[model samples]
Target: MAIKTKNISPDGKRQMTMQQFTAWLGRFDADKDGKISRQELADAVRGAGGRFAWWKCRQGLRSADSDGSGYIDANEIGNLVEFAQKHLGVKIVGF
Candidate 1:
């Protein structure tokens, strides 16, 4: 995630619409290539102060990149919902 637009709940989980969640993820597209690369994802998580960002990104990329393209694309963003909610503390409330 981009470490921006944090909407925390009382229980400490971040709440956001799917739009906000995807936007946050999109903020890390450093090359403006319309897809999130492994390096970009790792950098973003590390920038967010997440522990073991490399490892986490590895897993996230593995899980989210359903097509094995080694990047998260627009069509595959929803595949990241589960990983984001678990590791990124995001709750995508709705589309």
Candidate 2:
């Protein structure tokens, strides 16, 4: 399947700005709570054509859920950005 992405470049070599990255991630915020749940994150990875989405989600949540609230809030999204870039090849501009 074609890679589903809004911020990634055609050649996949450019970096996505934080605003772009968040807008992309915002698509998966099913509840519209302004926070990303584990399932939401997994869905995002899967939609991005990522492999091992659940595994990546587990690890991503582990590190990103700094408050241990089982949710990635605004403060924690920056953490998830790293995981997305590394595992999902999102290439966010900066952390």
The candidate that achieves the highest TM-score relative to the unseen native structure: 1
In candidate 2, which residue pairs get closer than 3 Å at backbone N, Cα or C atoms, i.e. clash?
A: none
Expressed as tens digits, the lDDT of each residue in 27-77 for candidate 2 is: 889999999998998998898788888999999999899999999988888
Kindly list the per-residue Cα lDDT of model 1 for residues 1-95, writing each as its tens digit.
34555577776777898887777777889999999999988876776667788898999999999999999999999988898778876677875
What do the candidate models score in CA lDDT, each in turn? 0.82, 0.80
- What TM-score would each prediction reach against the true structure? 0.87, 0.83
Indicate the TM-score of model 2: 0.83
Worst 10 residues of 2 by lDDT: 1-10
Candidate closest to the true structure, highest lDDT: 1
